[model samples]
Target: MNFARTKEEQDRLEQIGELAVRFSERAGKIDEAGDFPYENMEDLKKAGYTTWTLDKEFGGKGISLYEFLLYQEKIAEGDGSTALAIGWHMGTMMDLSTRRPWNQNVWKEVVEKVKKGALINTAATEPQTGSPTRGGLPQTTAVFENGQWVINGRKTHTTLSPVLDFILVKAYIPQRKKVGIFLIPKETKGVSVEETWNTISMRGTGSHDLLLKDVRIDEKYFVETVDPVNNQSAGWLLHIPACYLGIAGAARNYALRFSTEYSPNSIEGTISDLPNIRHLIGQMELELLQARTFMYAIAEKWDRSESKVELQAALGAVKHVAVNASIRVVDAAMRIAGSKSLFFENPLQRYYRDIRAGLHNPPMDDAVIAMLAQKALDGIQN
Candidate 1:
């Protein structure tokens, strides 16, 4: 099912997949303790995954979107929380490398840091407004003071904030009344993580509160104007669906293995021989097949196409369909596992809980449905 185009791409994915397998050995324990998977991040860096998506001109692998999505799925197979958290950095860095908005010196430093395995994430969510993608203005304020931009605000759900070397803050200048993103180094004064992430799903991700009180940085740190009205096709977000699909794949594999081996005294053969269990396995296979087909096909198309259609609706649908399918597949796997799936040590329960969290991620279910309805109505009017 992999679509790696080059030997280098194949070798890179194989290396990442190997690291992901090692990471999986600790995934359950990490979840139970609710701690960030710092080891997993470090392992990925050592495998050169951090620079896989960076442009070749920057002394990196420069993998394509299709290849990146495939590796993301591989990583999720080992640990979903880590996959989701780091995908933000991987995708954003790839996006920024080409269409950089900041000065060359600033961009050059960022590229160097990334090459050296530095993690970065956009801190756009706020306690007041939630995800900035919904067209809500950020309450975080920035002001120019003595050749420096002083920022004061708090952001919620800042995933991987603890390990991040650079934090991109979306803020408004009070004096100019203009909104823009300001980059803040982790060591900048008055910048800290508030240690507030405690969740049932994706608990290994340190998506805590990022607090910045009068965080001062050079004025050149302000970079990239986020325009909600004229956003380009977000093909990078395909990683979201890929991660969940990988989780579902793990659950499916577990169920299959258990069914083949487990036998009760009352049963003449393994549960896998039962018609109902076979039916459930068939169903899970179909779900994964459909999800993988859509995600990879669209990803490859995005890479090869010169121009892309309006992708907001497609991106929303991709997340909605793939996540829901993964959730359903996990549920089926649990049913096949019967009571064993409920055990604390079983991976099925973890998969079930982790997949549920994707329902709350950005491009929410309601927004996707609303967009579909509007598009349908507009088609009728036309």
Candidate 2:
């Protein structure tokens, strides 16, 4: 089922597939307990999977965007929570390496820690301001206190909070009227994680609330200012859709297997022989094909293209198509399962819930549509 075109890609995917098998074995248990997949993450770290996206100069493989998303989708098929949680760290590393927005010394320090199996995720979303993508100024504020920067605010949706080694917090500088990202090591004074993640979806992500009350850090930790709304397109964000697509793949596989095995006395063989079931299966395949084609094509294009700015609309389109298609694929799989999909013991129920989280992830559908509309209007006027 691995559609990798090259031998190297195939070999790498096989390795991830082995790890994913182990993760899949434990997925249901972790979901039932609603706990973070710490063991799965440890496995990734031990296998060097955690630093695969780092640049080659940083003592890592520096895999291409295509390779990254390919592995991400495979991992997600095994466990959506694990894939989604780790994708943030993986994508962040890729972005930092590509952008090199940090001071050279600071970037090297981060690379060293990441090479040593450290994890990171941005704490940007606030309860009041909602998604930082909406251009809402973060309520989180940082000020110069003596020689250090003191940051104070509570950030929600801080994924991987439990085991994060560093948190890149987005905060507003009231004195300067600018927004900047500050790197706060997990053990920094006054940095605390509140156990506030109690969602019914993607429960194992450990997306708790990050509380920073007068958190102190050196001035060097003030990484860079960001114009949230005007930030350039991020190819790394494709990981979000890739994760959901993998979940959809898992649901489709489950439905296929169930169809071939489940039979009733009234039927001749298995439910899979029925025309309606075949039609549903065909539709799911088509949906996956369309999404995967769009995702991989754009990812490969990103790897070769020099202009990410021009690809902004294309990137958003990929996420929009892939995510919506994944939802449809999962929903169809549920239809194939009928009422059994609702059972707690059925993994389809879990898949249903996990995939639903995609709708709320970054690059919200509304924004993407608006962007496309603006592009079309600009095109016509030109």
Instruction: Please name the candidate that would achieve the greatest lDDT relative to the true structure.
Output: 2
The TM-scores, one per candidate, come to 0.96, 0.99
TM-score of 1: 0.96
lDDT of 2 by residue, 24-119 (tens): 889999999989999999999999999999999998999999999999999999999999999999999999988899999999999999999999
Model 2 stretches with alpha carbons more than 4 Å out: none
Distance from true location, Cα of 34 in model 2, Å: 1.2
- The regions of model 1 sitting more than 4 angstroms off are 1-8, 228-231, 380-382
TM-score of candidate 2 to 2 decimals: 0.99
User: Tens-digit lDDT track for model 1 on 1-382?
Assistant: 5667789878878887888888789999999999999999998888788888888998887888889898998899989999999899999887787566688899889889888899999898888887676877889999899999889999999999879999999997779767889888999889989989888899988999999998999888988667643446678878889889989988998999999999998899899999999999999999998888877878877788776665567777888889999999999999999999999999889999999999888778898899888888988999
lDDT scores for all predictions? 0.87, 0.94
**How many clashes does each candidate structure show, in the order listed?**
0, 0
